[model samples]
Target: MSSMRLTGTPSWLNIKQRSARPGGGDDPSRGPQEPVRRVWAIGGGKGGIGKSFLAVNLATVAARAGWRVLLIDADLAGANLHTCLGVRGGNRVNLSDYLYDRVVDIDKAAIDTSVPGLRLIMGALDHTGMAETSRAQREHLFQALRKLPVDLVVFDLAAGADRATLDFFLETDEGVIIATPEPTSIENAYGFLRAAFYRRLARTMSTSPIRDLIREAMDRRNERGIRTPADLFKEIGQLDRGEEARFRQALEDFRPRLVVNQVRESEEIKLGFSMRSVCRKFFGINLEYLGYICFDDAVWRSIKERQPLVLAYPQSDAALYIRRIVHKMLGT
Candidate 1:
């Protein structure tokens, strides 16, 4: 189909188009109705870690697989998914407009793209007070998202663990954290994961007195004098068995998947496993190592051409790696 720009559409119209779908997945009548499973968010603590690249290509592959997809560029401050998808058009209404103007509907801001089975909601260029979405707005967005008919909605989140990003990440059915093999990226990825868990726990137990106790325990330094989450969990376990059980249950439930990007060598690819181990050993958290995307020139070429690598070179190594990830995610 032809690609449409985000420049002049009304927010409601945008949402309607994005929610439209041409169905062709597994047979719908043979068994129980598969619940509409839209809304996947892609995020990372560090920038330039291939989060957006993965987001675009993942959406492309999902759409190509016959699942209607709505790709939301939730990185309001630095939205660029449209560029990666080779979309052209100045967005008239973005996430910023929806946030600032009470009358603007977020759905109206969404636009159609050239890729069949895929649609997009662009982010605002002027992100001036749009960093943190209010609780009401977030609820509105999620409620609206649930009503959409698309089979999959992918959000390309802004980098970092800011309150807004973390909140959005928590709202999704699954979250994918992207990181490179570099020490800095690895550390930041861990930090982001911890922060996300903490935020989620805080929200779930906002009224609990143990919240303060857990926070204080997390602040303590270990024998090596390094403050760590595991140390805090152990201390909390000693202090209150019930709280510890709750904490462990929360940890077990917070399964954030990982993607090690930009791997140049076999050793670099192994970093994904190493990082997964560190997360389990140090933080008592189990992270699913989704898969690795090796460093490939085709990725750079696709970026230069403003296209998704999976679309530009479907059979390339990078594309294969991404497809493996998709299979793992879908359990197919």
Candidate 2:
């Protein structure tokens, strides 16, 4: 029998516990040595910014390039990613089934697409309640994604700044934020990043007195002029030197990449650079400008025909743009 020693400290202050990746070590599809997996979540501030379109075509292009990819339609309320991939009329296990426990395994629902190396775990748009996934379910699903055998996992997430949307955005290894040159889209894109930053900080410093300090900052944000990250950092350091390093580390690690879609002019392309600079100065979060895509009639034509753009028009300028984005994404 062992004597009970006094243990009165925050769990985080003690040894940090990492969540185990379920079945990730023995990936049956990839055999003994599993390849590295990359999970990319594509989201924008608004709809019609071409999040799903880019996601589907990128998956197709990557598959054509001889990489195994898995595309998940993360837009629970409006999951047309299956339609964009031309997956029609199949009674298959979807995200709903997995979430509701109709299926115990997530990989069991991965359906093969026309693209040889690409598989899809599709979502549902008809059941509006599907969007309200619990935090535990989301965490389990994310872990399940890591267990999949595919090299790349692309998530076409819903557009918004809601907790669900931002949760998916931050939960990924890296986030790909899509935005048009339009003013409203740009504004909302900033809004999304801002919310993500706060959410990250909130969760990171959740243990008091750091947690208590952050809560007070939130309550008195306007009164104390703690608007920018710089202001918050200064005040936090002044109050407690111990918490500053942790806060700085958390700030440095929240890097999100960007993509400008439907760019028609040089002026529009400059918006990406502008947004990057603004983020650095204001939020203190490093934003990588991945690249941009031009507006093309061929893309519209392909969409109207309900075909994957890269498959239908492989040599189109739009296809070349998609390839470039893929190269930069994989290179980074």
Best by TM-score: 2
Off by over 4 Å in 2: 1-36, 129-131, 212-221
**Residue-level lDDT tens digits of model 2 in 18-107:** 222312323445442364366788987688999999999988877776667888888877888778777883576688778778888888
Best by lDDT: 2
Candidate 1: tens digits of C-alpha lDDT, residues 90-197: 845566665656436556766778899888887766655335678787777777777666778898888888878888888874788999988888878987888888
Candidate 1 wrong stretches, greater than 4 Å: 1-36, 101-105, 214-226, 234-242
Every model's TM-score: 0.83, 0.85
Clashing pairs in 1: 10-108, 11-107, 11-108, 11-109, 12-108, 15-107, 39-153
